[model samples]
Target: MTVSDQTLSTAGTEVADGIVLTDVAASKVRSLLEQEGRTDLQLRVAVQPGGCSGLRYQLFFDERALDGDIVKKFGGVGVVVDRMSAPYLTGAVIDFTDTIEKQGFTIDNPNAQNSCACGDSFH
Candidate 1:
């Protein structure tokens, strides 16, 4: 696969398959990594089977460089997506939202036709 040609004027939200990491989310990820006192780990995003929808997302810190990984950087934080998940996550935006209702990382996936109630899974 190739990196998407589309890009936003705001900042470094551009990446392979059009997956974007917003500035706020990048800062949060940097803070979380700093708290752990390690720079070796990179944020890894993957799609796995399960959840109410056909696919579920998995986000975690990882150091291994899996084959065919799509790598990108946002505010010094590294984000990795596996080859298989890249297509599903194309044009997706990863953001951090904090409000009275909720606070945490969020994925805005354009590819998903519909998502479950919790919003943890999509198809």
Candidate 2:
């Protein structure tokens, strides 16, 4: 409901329950939103069954606020995590990295016991 100022860099900002968004990640999100010129979308993070390990992380922009959706904000960026995916994402940190080796958003989840080598799935 409340929107504040910008970015969390290396450290992260905690969401409604336990998920986190690093400042750089937030800035990237905000940048994306600005590029799209849409204010109704929120970054939705969810876990779905599939992938090599078992469950896979899903991240995307969403406008629908489903029932049981958990919402939180980091600066002007809003984030939503469904009730079912909440537990799996506990203590999870979402960050953006742009090194010569790799570039993109990454999730660091403490709840994952085992993740596939390709990094797309987890158990």
Q: What is the TM-score of each candidate against the true structure?
A: 0.88, 0.89
Task: Write candidate 1's Cα lDDT for 9-122 as tens digits.
Answer: 366454545788888888999999999998999899899998899899899999888888887777778888889988988889899999999998999888999999988888
Error of 1 at 25 (Å): 0.3
Q: Summarize candidate 2's per-residue lDDT along 1-123 as a digit string, tens digits.
A: 333333333335645467788778889999999999999999999999999999999999999888888877876689888889999999898999999999999999999999999999999
Q: Which runs of model 2 end up more than 4 angstroms from their true locations?
A: 1-12
Query: What local distance difference test score does each model get?
Result: 0.83, 0.85
lDDT of 2 at 116: 95
Clashing pairs in 2: 8-23, 9-23
